[model samples]
Target: MNFYLDVDRTIITKEHREALELNDFLKYLFNTGEVYWLTTHCRYEDTSSVLSYIMPFLTLENYDLIKNIFPTTWNTLKTEAINFSQPFYWFDDYLLEVEKRILLENRCLEKWIKIDLDKNGNNIMRAAKSHNPNLFSSI
Candidate 1:
């Protein structure tokens, strides 16, 4: 399975200023070798910068490896960039109407996590807990 995430308000939110908690969650996902950044900042040449800001606690080596996850969206539509053949969990604060329709049509809506920054601000942490209650116990 693959894990995709948006930056900005979804992972790094106004409610929670720090990303240590989210980084812990993503670090677990990264170990699976299927984590992806599905945000605008990913369009830049240096995609690692996106994760760097949101995952300040992550080491440079790990960040470099993440940057190597080539296929990081640069001017490509997310729907087209992602291969829906494999199961994936996507977390995004905003999804275009067309994108929502496509996911629903493909029966992939269930995999999408809508991160409403205005409400349910802690959904990311909640997702981590749902995956494993003891996952973030140390952090």
Candidate 2:
């Protein structure tokens, strides 16, 4: 399965904080393979920098695979990038209602995970750890 992610509040946790930590949700997605950035931050350098920043949290064995799938730049919205023919997992704190409707229409709602950074707080680091691993077994 392919993974799409948002950076800002979804990954970085804080906009003003220069040094950031990897949250569990992101770690799980990275390990899953072929992770692509879906943020409004379209610069290639910034994307690379964040990937490097989270390096320590990632398993070294998957580093090469992760690098191969990491996008150099992101210029499209997650909703725009999604292709329903292929299975994809989208993680973002702010998916619009219209976007949700599109996913439902396309029968892609199962993989469109919505996360709230504010409510989850720092516990976002533990978010994916407790999930049912078989939840996507059929995918």
Steric clashes per prediction: 0, 0
Q: What is the C-alpha RMSD of each candidate to the true structure, in Å?
A: 5.2, 5.1
- For model 2, the run of ten residues with the poorest summed lDDT: 15-24
Model 1 pairs whose backbones collide = none
Query: What's the lDDT for candidate 2?
Result: 0.57
lDDT values of the candidates? 0.63, 0.57
Candidate 2 residue 113 C-alpha distance from true site, Å: 1.3
TM-score of 1: 0.67
Please write out the lDDT profile of model 2 over residues 1-55, one tens digit for every residue: 7877766666545543311234344456666656776766534535566567655
